[model samples]
Target: MTTTDAAAAQSTAEEREALRQMAAEFTRREIAPHLQEWEDAGALPRELHVKAGRAGLLGVSFPEAVGGSGGDLLDTVALQEGMFSQGASSGLMSALFTNGIACPHIAAHGSSELVDRWVRPTLAGELIGSLGITEPGGGSDVGNIATTAVRDGEEWVINGSKTFITSGTRADFVTTAVRTGGPGAGGVSLIVVPTDTPGFSVDRKLAKMGWHSSDTAELSYVDVRVPVGNLVGDENAGFWYIAEQFVVERMALAIHGYGIAERSLELTVDYCRQRSTFGEPLIKRQVVRHKLVEMRRQVEAAKAYTHAVAAQYVAAGGPNEAVIAAACMAKETACNTATYVTDQAVQLHGGTGYMHGTEVERHYRDARLLPIGGGATEVLTDLAAKLLGYTR
Candidate 1:
């Protein structure tokens, strides 16, 4: 969904530059030094969140009214761009900035109490929040939630399960999609259930081929209950709430796709300049030079297209066909770039890229998930097609 900040857009180039530098420096000092260790540990420490919150990095794109640093989506784009440029991985971004997904709904449409209880602290990095939408049996089907939330006299009793939840193992609460009315799309509603609530449990810490540093969890909500006042907006509006949020997710993942692709290209470029192939630097060969040019071309196109979509989406002030279609297209474009460029990065690095500890190697594995995460490219493509009237 488009999160509108009442605070003026921090749209100035200079502000973005400053934000970029801050993000870059933060990554260099806090993240770069220990990324490998965290990846090995399969999760980031909570202390990192506290540090980032203290630094105001956690709230860059959120409004000051809600404890954010008071900027728009462009500021977020700039921040992530800088981090990725400084070798931050997609997994790290997901784990650290889960608030990007978790808090926007509260910040936008939730009650004052909800904002105070969850959004503010989350943006401030004191508390971690997660979005629980993908159930064990279905993803990309917001209308088909199996989770049920029955309203008691003063509480919402929730029962169902969520999987592939980012930061689920560490979250203070999950802004969950639950069924409250009849069956299907019209029945769904969003309710914030604190992780410590009765019957709420992290069933398992999932192991993944990528995003290892970001803890993914299988969560069970067996009679989890929260205050009835925890409902976000009206009951049975969860489908629209979740659907809009998914668009923003697509936009975020687009940034992730191109951001990592650009970083991988830079790393590969430096390696090519130093590594000798057949007794000559790889950059000296025509084929290698051509490959580098193609990689740069893809990265540039993806970045440009994604940025344009973000701008248009922001300018639209709310959802529009152009905005939605562009968001979908941008994600597909950037995801394609990430996969292609990361593969080439590994190919160019030859044996070195295949090594476990190599930066490009990690990116190679991480890039494989961009198309699959957020929304699968195939699914988004069809949505975009329908929006663009490309479907019968």
Candidate 2:
């Protein structure tokens, strides 16, 4: 390689190492201690957001101009990998970095006023934000959203509800998807709705199969009035904006998938080494050694593929059709790896793994959400088929 190329490579390595170390330290100091408490409480302290922001961990992949710490997708991958490998669960990642989903559209499209009001504070950790798209019965069908935002003089009266909203109960503002025009995709628009609005309310906190520390809510808006200025981008253009973000969100999930797998494998390896089965170390058994190797192999492969896709995304400046299909594949691949690896981790840990308080148990539960959340594996498979032109 040329001198310039070598320098660039060196610089990148240093940056990645620094990000990883920061993630490890932050997880160890700020999160791991109180993880169980937060999980039991069903929410993280709002103070955690402030600490993450102070540490520049909250907006690592966001634009610096908007109170973010100027980084890219790969930086986020490094952070996630580091955190997971250091005992942080996927639930913590989602709750802490909900901004990765919530503020992107606004940072990229919303007016400066909107950015100042929501994006800046969110990135700075002073405010919590959530993306409201999935509705009851609608699932991943963004086009079929039942929420309506009709213009009434200077304000838009929004009437509808969003379900499975991440960080919803604690969000100060939500970047909500609503119908503003005709039917289907063309009618959709994104509007920022403050939680203080009179008609907006959290219907209830939905208890989940995993990610216990992350708060999820079913939110309702009954004739909630928001200013027209709160609209993100142009009217009836939210679908494209949301579609554009799916690439990153899916990629992030892919990273989460393998990161968790890698962590589980690490925990399992240590367990196997020290765990005695029939008076011998579990690792002494051929079957146990093979299982550990298989777990590592899968985790490495998933990480490599996900990182490659992330690199391609960075190289291309943005995601295109090809990148989108590959992202779907990456997410599915990593999530499947996570499932298998975490299960093996539990199996290797024997009865200890089945216990609720065990680390491997938490990973096992957290890994279960990978395939189902973001875009479900089935839905993404269909999307990939269409993207690859397998569908007529």
Candidate 3:
């Protein structure tokens, strides 16, 4: 279908519900069963991406001409929420949605050749791609990245290392941020580095406290040569692109944060109702009941604020700095709330929640990454302050 036609279809409530139901079924069938095994293995099977692609869940927000469903931000948000609500793990979502981070650069700025070669195949799930921006020394500081891409005759020699890369080990291509000019954000640019290219190596898959199935990695580029044509956008213009994209990245992290909290709350409620303490159901205790009530309140509040910010973003048809600030605030709110909810869920579960395989246990570990990932809570708060012109 044409982009306009698909978008028109998604504008209706019926179409949106159909898409959400499809995503829900796909998550239950493909993701729910294997989550524990995948979590233990520290990486999901790549086939899940192919399955999700076939179900039309992978391309909901892209243009139809590029093999997408041509839906807007809300449709994508619904798909994300539905998958999580249907028991898809946060690790699976991060690995599966790595394309959301990788494809945008090519779609927005790459040459037609790059788009045809990488973006289309990735959206089709024929290949996996990831974004590499956070470096070993420059966590959440894009401007100070130390990776250098020096131009040669027809190629750029790349030499740098990236750490904390989501889906890094299994990625077929990496949209890498590199320093092409001088120090700082103004000198940075993005380049597509194919895994097969010489001097590009997966240094080591880093073990983490959570999101085990997502395959975080440390990547090393030692004199890797990439065609100059692989440059995304103008040379030395990558900082602006990366900065602009942070809003969506932060929003995605926010969704994961709150979605996991909501799921944890649901499970906790069921557990509380069934398990008794002091000769009554645990939930009958005033303290336990109040804790559950607080958890529900936080999740609902976070969801509402996130939805409002996302709606404003979609209606504007582009990134508004204010909306971006709002998204950051929502992310911080959700992450903190999720932390509280998950911790309380664990407390409510007592020993059961402490078990390794319990859903709440997984959530408690996974929730730790929310404030640290996308951007640290401190960094985001500082950014928010700066955006509001709040200076000491």
Candidate 4:
């Protein structure tokens, strides 16, 4: 390679390392210590967001003009990888980074007033926000949202329920998907509703198999009224907006899949070296050695594929259906890797891996959610089939 090309490569590597280290440090210092307590509490402290915001960890990919740290999507990926490297659970990352999903639309297209009220505070860690998309019976059917938002002179009155909402238990507001017109995709609109509205309530906190620290909620909205100005972008354009953002969301899930798998592999390797059975360390056994190597291979493949697709996504400069299809494939690949790797990590760790306090155990539980959350693996595969023209 030419001298200048080598220099550019070195610079890029250094920049990526910097972002990674920043996230790792926060995980080690702030999250690792109190993680178990938060898990038991079933939620993270609101103060943690402020600390992360002050550390510039909360807004890595948002535009600086919108109170972000002026980084890009690659930066966000680097941050997530770093945290996972430091043993941060998927649940903790989801709870802390809820703003990543909640504030993007507002930052991109909400009126200045709405942005200031929701997006800025959220990125600043002064407020919590969640995206309300999935409902109890209407999972993955964005076009069939049953929640209705009717125009009432200067305001919109919303009535419906949202289920399986991340961070919903504590979010100050929600970016809700509501039906505003007819009975299809074109009639949906994204509206912001404050939690304090008399008719809006967090009905209950839901428990899950993993992500114990990230609080999920079943929310009910009964005639909740808000100004029409709170609508994100144009009326009945929410389906398009949600579709535009799916690539990034799927990429984030893909990152979680591989990131957790990578961490699991790392822990398992160390345990094998130190763990003894019969006459020698587990690493001395041929079968154990082969398992370790295969685990490493799968993790590497998943990581490389996801990162390549992410780079393509950034280079595209906007939403593209082909890229979205590729992202769905990436997510499935990584989730599959994570599932296999985490399960092996547990098996290699033997009885200890099954214990509740073990990190491998935590990952085993957390990794299960990736294939189900964001968009379920089954749903994404169907979507990809359609996107790729396998069906008419």
Candidate 5:
């Protein structure tokens, strides 16, 4: 490479390192200590979001005009990696950064009034926001959602329920997907639904096998009155927003999956060297050694693939159909890697790994949701195949 090219690359690397350090410091001080307690309690305190926002970690990729630091995708990835490396749980990240999913649609398509009302508070961490799309009957199938928003004078009367909504229990606002016209993707629309709206209520917080610190909810909308101005983009164009957001969401999930597993592997390696069995260190055994080696290999491979995909995504200027397929592949790879690594970490720790408070154990539990959430592995594989023209 030329001297100028090398200098620019170095500059970027330095900036990434600086951002990583900032995130690491914040994770160690703010998140690591209370993670177990928060998990046991099944939800993190809202103050965590305020702290993160004050630290400039919450708006890494957003525009500076929107209360962000004007960083790129690489900066966001670095922040995620640093948080996991410093012991922040995936659940904590999800709960604290729920705005990433919620505000993007509004920022991309909402009216100026809508943006000021919701986006500003969300970025400032004064208000919580969540994306609501998954319905009771329709899981990841965005096209066949049963929720409807019928026009009634100057307002839209919304009726239906959404399940598996991340941060739903605590969100001040929800960017909801509703069927505005006929069936299929063409009839979908996105709308900003405030929690205080009449007939909008959180039914119940859903219990999950993992991500305990992140509150998930089943929400009910019974004749919810939302202003017509709340519609995002054009009416009957919600599918495009959903598709765009899914790609970024999948990529973020992929990063969280692999990053957490990488941390688990690091902890396990240290334990193996320090903890002796049968008058020898665990690392002394060839089998245990090979296990650690394999864990490293898998995590490294997944990270590399995820990073490459993220680079491609930014290069392509946000997500499209092609990037969505790539994001799916990356998420699947990272999730599978996380599962493998966490299992190995647990085995290496033997009895302690099986305990509830153990980090590896927590990671094992958290990793379970990786494949099921975002988009299921089976669904993603099918989508990818269709995208790649494998279907007739």
Candidate 6:
């Protein structure tokens, strides 16, 4: 690399480091204190969004022109890592940063009016936004959405119900995927539906085995009428828009998987060093020492591979075929690491790890969802095979 390139790389490193520190500090002060309370309540307080917005951590990865702190995916990854280091849980992240998934499509493709009305204010924490793609009947076949948005003059009349919607109960609006044309991927279109509009209702908050702090909703839309201007980019381009984000979304889940594993390792290591068994510290035992080594190896390998995939994605400006394959693999690898490491963490913690409200126990439960969300591990593995031409 040339001197100029080297200098730029150094600058990027320094900036990411500073961002990591800021995020970690914010988590220590803001999130760590009352996480359990929110977990118990089964939802986070709206004030948390306001607080994150004020800290500038909430919008760290969005563009400054749209009221964000102006960074990219790598920066957000750093922010995530820092927060995880400071004991941020997966549920906390899903609840606190729902905007990460919600506003990207709007910011990238919405009209200027829509950007101002939704993206800007949402990033500023004055409003909450959510993406509604999953439905009550369909799984990952996003193209087969049962939701219908038929055009009538100047408005699209929408009728459908969405399930497993993250941050759904708290969202001011939903960026909904609806069928506007035929019966395939090409027919899907995105429309922004305000929550309080007539015929829109949050059916209920769904309970989960984990991610308790992150509210999930079952939403119903009965002949909801939204203006034609609420369309994201074009009449039938929602599939492309959503597909475009899959790489980064998968990478984010990869980070979440291994990020919690790293934290679980830390907690387990401390616990082993402190806890006694057979009149000696657990860390002194041969088997316990080996377990710690194996845990570190998995965490390190997953983090390294995921970060590499993220860098490749950033350098390419998007996901090419190779990036997509690597991202899928990275997610699967990290998720596997998370499942193994978190399970080991709990086992190493003994009875304390199984207890509700214990940190390792929380991680153990939260890790279960990573492989399922963002796309199931089985789904991603098959996708990677197809992209890599292994199916032939």
Model 6 lDDT tens row, 230-340: 999998999999988888788989999999999999999999999998899999999999999999999999999999998999899887999999999999999999999
Evaluated at residue 74, the lDDT of candidate 1 is 79
Q: Would you estimate the TM-scores of all the predictions?
A: 0.96, 0.99, 0.96, 0.97, 0.98, 0.99
lDDT of each candidate versus the true structure: 0.90, 0.93, 0.89, 0.92, 0.90, 0.92
lDDT of 6: 0.92
Regions of model 4 farther than 4 Å from truth: 1-10
Error of 3 at 101 (Å): 0.6
Query: How far out, in Å, is residue 73 in model 4?
Result: 1.5
The digit string of per-residue lDDT tens for model 3 on 194-237 reads 99999999999999998888899999999999999999989999
Model 4 TM-score, all chains together: 0.97
RMSD of each: 3.5, 0.9, 3.1, 1.4, 1.2, 0.9
Model 3 residue runs over 4 Å out of place are: 1-11
| lDDT for each residue of candidate 4 in 206-290, tens digit (9 for 90 to 100) | 9999999999999999999998899999999999988888788889989999999999999999999999999799999999999
Error of 4 at 235 (Å): 0.2
- Residue 282, candidate 4: alpha-carbon lDDT: 99
Can you write out model 5's per-residue Cα lDDT over 1-392, one digit (the tens) per residue? 99999999999999999999999999889999989899988887888888887888888988876667787777889999999998887888889999999988888788889988988777887889999999988998999888999999999999999999999999998999999999999999999999999899999999998899999999999999989999988999999888888887888899988998999999999999999989999999999999888999999999999999999998898876788788999999999999999999998999999999899998998999999888899999999989988897
- lDDT of residue 177 for candidate 3: 97
Question: RMSD, model 4, all Cα superposed?
Answer: 1.4
- Residue-by-residue lDDT tens digits, candidate 1, 1-392: 23443233433777899989999999999999999999999999999999999988889878788898888777889999999999999999999999989988888879999999999888777899999999988887778889999988999999999999999999999999899999899999999999989899999999998988999999999988789999999989888887777777889899999999999999999999999978999999999999999999999999999888888877887568888888999999999999999999999999989998789999988989999998888988999999999887
Clashing pairs in 6: none
Regions of candidate 2 where Cα sits further than 4 Å from its true position: none
Write down the lDDT that model 1 would get: 0.90
Mind sharing the TM-score for model 6?
A: 0.99
